[model samples]
Target: MLSPKKIRHRKTFKGRMKGVANRGATLEFGDYGIKVLTCGWITSRQIEAARVAMTRHVKRGGKVWIRIFPDKPITKKAQETRMGKGKGSVEYWVAVVRPGRILFELGGADDELSMGALSRAVAKLPLPCRIVKREEL
Candidate 1:
């Protein structure tokens, strides 16, 4: 699983999601990428699963770039626990995803191979996503 080696705080507030992602929306590092169509939380486990699927499909031939990181800590209360104790303990980390954010990118692969690898990764994700080609310059 991908996680930060060190974090400033153990627990943090849940931030607000308002607009489309201003940053990380463009494919900066690959020829083909996965663009999210909706906003949601992407757990580290989900990211890892998608990466595994993509790598396996490509047989490690192409280079992959993960554009997002799960730095936000999500706290959770125990099951059936009484309320009013305080904020729950940190349960897991999630990458807060906004619409139009690019999640994964692939380079060094042909169109057919790239699409096939990306499709495999898309199935592991929770949101609807599309494989996008890099803009010609």
Candidate 2:
């Protein structure tokens, strides 16, 4: 379980995700994962790194949770197109970054690129967010 402060940080850091799903895929909680607690914005390149790492360990499976503020605003044409005008209400996102695959459990953003919170959240996780092979698990 995450501490409340960490949970809050996670919400603040999840600003860059798309939206949320009740229970989507079998890969809900990644086999290997990182839970982040943040407040500021992150970059695409950083997210890409985590994604790349996750991909390398695809067999093991991994997920990155980024938490952010709920009422913060997002200003991107792409976001408007994907999430509409009244979105961005949630507080975090779950991004699974794999080399050949990047799965995003968006909280309240538009496109995956805008998910800075996801990137930051991934950075905060204690362990490296690399997906290991089934053999390791």
Tens-digit per-residue lDDT, 81-134, candidate 1: 999899899888899999999999999988999999999999999999999999
Highest lDDT: which candidate? 1
State in Å the error of residue 134, model 2. 16
* Residue pairs in clash, model 1: none
Give the winner by TM-score: 1
> What tens-digit string does per-residue lDDT give for candidate 2 at 1-137?
11123332322332343333223222333332232222233334344555554444332333344222223222334443665564345432333322222133332232232244345445644333332211233
TM-score of each: 0.93, 0.26
Error of 2 at 4 (Å): 31
After superposition, the stretches of candidate 2 with alpha carbons farther than 4 Å from their true spots are 1-27, 58-137
Q: Candidate 1 overall Cα lDDT vs. reference?
A: 0.93
lDDT of each: 0.93, 0.34
